[model samples]
Target: MQNKNHELHVICVNLLATLWDYNRVGKDAEDGDIEEIISMASKSDLADQEKQVQENIHSQITNFCTFMDQILLPESKSHETTSQKHSTAPRPSGLSLAIGRNAPPDTKFEIPETKPLTFAESCQRIKDLMGYTLELKPSQIPHEQAGQGLFVDGEADVGSVIALYPGVIYSPAYYRYIPGYPRVDSQNPYLITRYDGTVINGQPWGTGGETREPWAHSNVYRPNPSEPPSETGSDRVWKMLSKPLEGSRLGFNGEVLERRNPLALGHFANHPAMVMEPNVMVCPYDFPLNEKGMRAYIPNVVFGGVEEVKMKRFGSFWFKSRGESNDGQMTGPVMKSLALVATRLICNEEVYLNYRLSNSKRRPSWYTPVDEDEDRRRWS
Candidate 1:
């Protein structure tokens, strides 16, 4: 139940984060101002009536989580999720190159002598905390290219945070520097975008994790020099754009983060089939960097590095399935990442998420729109 409430708080955090941007349409904002515009609606500065509105939003999210719990609790008992046989052995930890193989010049963040948390250890902690475990193996999605999939190895109740999407986070300001800019989706399909335009590339934090050492994230997605160049308008725009400098002045060496969170394989979950309803939904989570106790579990690193930005201004609503700016384009102190939350009781079965691929782009043959209206709203 504690885990459920934490998940509920995250959902509301996102819904309210966009409240500040709901109004006040104007010209583009400067670096600092751009970050502020997406922040949480200020409570201290609000008028009495506005304060009441803020309070009202809090109540609604709480009530919604409670309502869903009431409805899903009974259904959980009748149907168990055993569609395919799971690999009973613990999955392998994500591969990691030996420490110091490619050490950066900036020695600010040191290489610790102690080994970081292991995949099996992280999985044990999650099960102890949430009463469920997860698995990853060949997916049985009936497609020729089902690749890999995330599975709930134990019973998971509704509103539980099932998996976390890990890797370096790119804020709106840093879009130009993404491994493949104008065509950010060019080579990798693990990228997910927040409504505020923050993008997280999950390709770096693949499968599960083995270490908390500074895993180089942004370094993994560099454009392949050998690939044939294309004449597409997207390619031309990117090639013509002046490249912005990377790295952080705020003391961060750049996109190296702890890739040791075992549940960070949220990227492995596949889009649901045409006949299936998604069992899990994407929820935006703002991991507070200062919280030492829970810090290790939150595995993400800021890209360019951001200046001071208020944390409250950039949280989510309780219902979200979905951040800010800077001079060189960096994220706020809060590392924003996506997490998959179970919408229904799940047993030993594959987790399905609505990919919500944009209609503006060409989609795969197996792809079907989960909600046409949602795709329009997102890409438009």
Candidate 2:
């Protein structure tokens, strides 16, 4: 009975987390208006249309709640004479999990001390190593009268601090890996690079994206700051290049599986400056989720940093694209939401794991799907 209860709790948490992830991306303020307008367009009467849509949405919610109630109920029956059957359980729909908020903050905020490095030195180091600039965003630089113009107290190395938080301090590294000839290899380059982020041979690997495989000779170690530059480097070069780079021409090739319009109506009503931009790169391959049929396509937190950009893109009066490719042909929306979702999901998982480890819980169940084994079995 206890084991079944524990399973129920686990399943509920996983389902809730999955739904939350979808709502974060799919549910926009504009959805209500869109639904209303669509209903009005379809029906002659405004009140009747509104009521119909409301009823439809309500039915969907009620069905979900009923499913949850059934799943969470214990299966075992008590034989005691005085025992009574379980009463109807009131199911919670779309309840937010605020469990970790009350936990006391961890005190292990002690960052390591290193040799002093100036801003210029840091910029030079990144340029020399990765052939790119490390210009700090305005927010990252220390302001006058703010802690004596230092980013933090007792921080001697500016370079190290910036590197420690590159995503926050500077724009993240964005490179365009042009799909190579014979198409499939170039399009699916990322698949070769990312890891599943599982530990093997006592080493950690597999989180998906840019960490999967290696260059033929240098496949042993993932690229890191300490590693030397590859002589036979990938054609996926830095965005900032000296010459007219080979992969500069933007390409769009992929299929759109799903889409959600942004909420704000007047976002791009008369904005003439908005143009349909080409994709940064073209992949000749489909995302893994397409093959696996996973509804939990990508996690939200992975690409949370780009939340502002994504929101603006969706909210603005413009048509965003989703795409897929086959037979070396790219089709569908010019841009892929899956890529964005993938990035966010990956980042979110990393953040969750890091936070859990910092909080003294070595294993954060958030990243590990509770029903993963069951899912595999069912699929198989």
- Which candidate number has the best TM-score? 1
Q: For model 2, how does the per-residue alpha-carbon lDDT over 116-140 read when each residue is reduced to its tens digit?
A: 4433443344334332322212222
Models 1 onward score TM values of 0.60, 0.17
- Candidate that scores best on lDDT: 1
Judged by whole-model lDDT over C-alpha atoms, candidate 1 comes out at 0.54
lDDT of 2: 0.21
Q: How many Å off is the CA of 192 in candidate 1?
A: 0.5
Q: Model 2 off-target regions past 4 Å?
A: 1-55, 73-302, 305-380
Error of 1 at 118 (Å): 4.2
Worst 10-residue lDDT window for candidate 1 reads 313-322
C-alpha root-mean-square deviation, each candidate: 15.3, 27.2
